[model samples]
Target: MSSSPAKPTSQHTSDHFRFHRPLAHLSGPFGNDSFALRAEAFARFFGTPLFLGAQTLIVVLWVGCNMAGLVHFDLYPFILLNLAFSLQSAYAAPLILLAQTRQAARDKAHADADAQHREALAVANETRLAAAALNSQQMLTLLQQNTELTEMTRQLTERIERLTVEMHERFVIHGSAP
Candidate 1:
């Protein structure tokens, strides 16, 4: 009697269905990886081949002007081009770094927010449980008190009846003697 192995259960099947429902419109297209997004932004801004081509064209134009004697021996165009490229690099590097830092901070903030939400939910659930327990205890105490009061009332009534009968017998016997 050999038994077949059980199939493995899907990990996120419920979550997938929950998000894919018609009314669930809160799903996002992006995953958790922000580094890839940041890298793509950096590439779009600074790593395009077109920028290199433009730089090369500028250099060529400066060289051509210098060679044709149309410019001075100081090579001012070349100096300016180099200065612009240097400045662009300086600023672009810092901007990219800043973007990455901001992304990290944003991710951290999201994680912190999720943690806080979970903590709040846990506290709410605990409060509900505590309240339910307190209500149950109070109900039990009230029931016990009601039972004790009922018993005490029954005992007092019985004692009053016994005393009344004894007083009536004593009064009747005294009246008959008179």
Candidate 2:
């Protein structure tokens, strides 16, 4: 087995993967907490009875003026209404874009934090594994040393016994001659 790190080969390349993918082309930028907050704000602003009453008042005033023949079809009231709608659309688009940008930034921050946490966890696990390997190696070395000491003790005991036996035989042989 090779000790080198694994490298991606041609077989691992994805046909569908694009290196030049645009950020604007990706979806789900508005699918976050800030976007939800902005949507809720929009709903709250537009869904109020006060807003409805104001709209009704404007429509009634326009119709009343039209019926009374005080305002012409090509003049003031219709133009004002069109201007208001255009302004609302323009402002709403930017506000929604701002909310989506904020949400995307928040999501990116969270993703970065998660990546950092995973990296820390990987480092901790590697440290634990290295410590375990070191402990195992130390234990094996100690056991080998212990076995060698026991064998040395046994050999020393055998040599002591043989020397004692030789000394006894010499004593017996000399005493019998005397």
In terms of TM-score, the best-performing candidate is 2
RMSD of each: 12.4, 13.0
Candidate 2 C-alpha lDDT tens digits along 38-105: 76477446658998898889878877787688877735456776887798788777666766676677
Clashing pairs in 2: none
TM-scores of the candidates are 0.40, 0.49
lDDT of candidate model 1 versus the reference = 0.70
Q: Backbone collision count in every prediction? A: 0, 0
Locate the minimum summed-lDDT window of 10 residues in model 2: 17-26
lDDT of 1 by residue, 1-178 (tens): 9899876678634553432344222222122368656654654567678878987897788788887889865374467667777988886887667666655765665566667767988999999999999999999999999999999999999999999988778788556442
Runs with alpha carbons beyond 4 Å of true place in candidate 2: 1-40, 43-87, 164-178
lDDT of 2: 0.72
